[model samples]
Target: MEVSYKEEVSVGALVILGLVAFTLGMFWLTGRSIVSKGIGVDVVFKDVSGLKEGDPVRVSGVTKGRVARVHLDKVGKVIVTIQVSSDVRPHADASAAVASADFLGAKYVAYNPGAKDEPLAQGTPIPGVAEEQFADIASRAASNASQLIENVNRGLNPGQLAADLHNTLVVTQRGMKALSEASNGPMVQQTTQTLKTVQNVMARIDSVLGTRDAAASGRRLDTLTANLGQLSAHLAAATKSLNELLTTMNKGEGTLGRMATDTMLYKNLNATLAALSSLLTDLKERPGRYLTVKVF
Candidate 1:
């Protein structure tokens, strides 16, 4: 009976140990515990606030990893090292920001996995994101509220405000009365007459534009049409002559074509031009000896 009791106690102890081991294994597999098996990244924060070891690291509100360690560097800044799962690549653009989980000052590192092309390596430092503290926001709100209250106090003058409002109401009432008067009787009749005058002027202009005499008001248009027709015929003849000239030039038939294509014609033309220039110079110096002018 003593041996059976001892055996039962031993079995109970073994079962408890197995349960504990199973729980630990499950935690490790689910990445709940701080294990040094995965990729590590470092982040520097201005203030750790209430962040601690084994705190979950979230990416866009989803838990991806945990904070492995938090320590102060030589410069006295809080340097936090986080271990994330190897499956997720935290790129270089990934930022670390402190976020509160509850009112109990429980803070965690939140990450933004930005720009997929640049995957962060082991021991890489993530850039810190600017976090607005609740205290600072509350202080700013209080200051703004105080300023608004001061502005209201400065602007609130009951007597002057009442007088201004009364004056504005009186002016508005008078303006409404004037507008009502203008919309009725003789004023409306005058507006109608003006509109009718405008309509009549527009009708007259339309009639003038539609009239045959108005269409033929200027003789310059007829003259221009005749001149354009003659110019067009002359241009057509000139174009035909130009085409024939181009054809003759292409066949090297004219003097200009020979001058363009033949080197001998170019030399002869050059000599002739030089000789003509010299004869003109001599005739200008001694005009009567070069030629006698006879009027018959």
Candidate 2:
């Protein structure tokens, strides 16, 4: 009876162990291995989107690791811890990125090895690049479009829009009417006549400057310019001679120059003129007395 009871207990214990092993096997098959041991590398991402724990981490498309944990940091970025295998050596400058596994939105981490010979130290926080998932993007775009449509429906008023359009048309109509009235006024006619006159004057000027007359006028202009140049040269020579004559006169070299510069000569000439004037006055006033004595 004791041997049978021990055999029953051993069988029961074996059955329980089998069940536990099956459960572990099932979890391991589903990529939730309890015995997974590797170095944990923290990676930060702005958005992980569809990435989750137990997602396979790949190096050059080969599965070498798995994501251990995913959480948000203090600054709201998605912090994902990747558990890399002990055999694989990822560089320090290696980068981590998220990728879609299939069209069903399963995501995984993609590792890019850096060119460094040294491997990344354990527990190092690597930078993560958030690749945009097509599904997520399409979903967000659809959601945003739906939200925009709802906002438009809530905020837009058809009646107010129509009224604003009507007011704008009214303002435009009044402006057009004012412009039409100004265009039809006498000022417009006067401006038109002035413009016509200016056009006629311009036509006349064009006729005067026709090709044949232009050549003839050009020759005449050349002759006039030549004559002006000669005149200018002659004027310059005359001015130089006049300057020399003025310099000679200033030096009292000529009779006119001496008379102009000599103060004593001027005083003597004034005295002689005064004496002649006085004798002329006396002869005019006493002409009868002098003539009578000569006649007797």
Candidate maximizing lDDT: 2
- lDDT of model 2 at position 208: 47
Please list the residue runs of candidate 1 whose C-alpha ends up more than 4 Å from where it truly belongs after superposition: 1-35, 74-76, 157-296
lDDT of each: 0.71, 0.75
Would you estimate the TM-scores of all the predictions? 0.44, 0.42
- Displacement of the residue 30 alpha carbon in candidate 1, Å: 13
Query: Which predicted model would earn the best TM-score?
Result: 1
Model 2 per-residue lDDT tens digits across residues 1-296: 25798899999999999999999887776576687687778888988977888899998889988888999876659899888886665688988999888889888999876778888786677899988879668999999999999899778878888888986775455445444645744445555555565565555455546647667768756655565565556556556655765576568666445555555765687799999999889889988755665444
Q: Could you give me the TM-score of model 2 versus the true structure?
A: 0.42
Please, what are the lDDT tens digits per residue for candidate 1 over residues 1-296? 25698899999999999999999987776546633666778888877776778788888788888888888785548888888777666787788888888867778888776777967775778776536777888999999999999898779977889988986775455445434644654435545555565565556555555657744634545544555565556556556665765576556676444544555765686799999999999989999987898999
Clashing pairs in 1: none
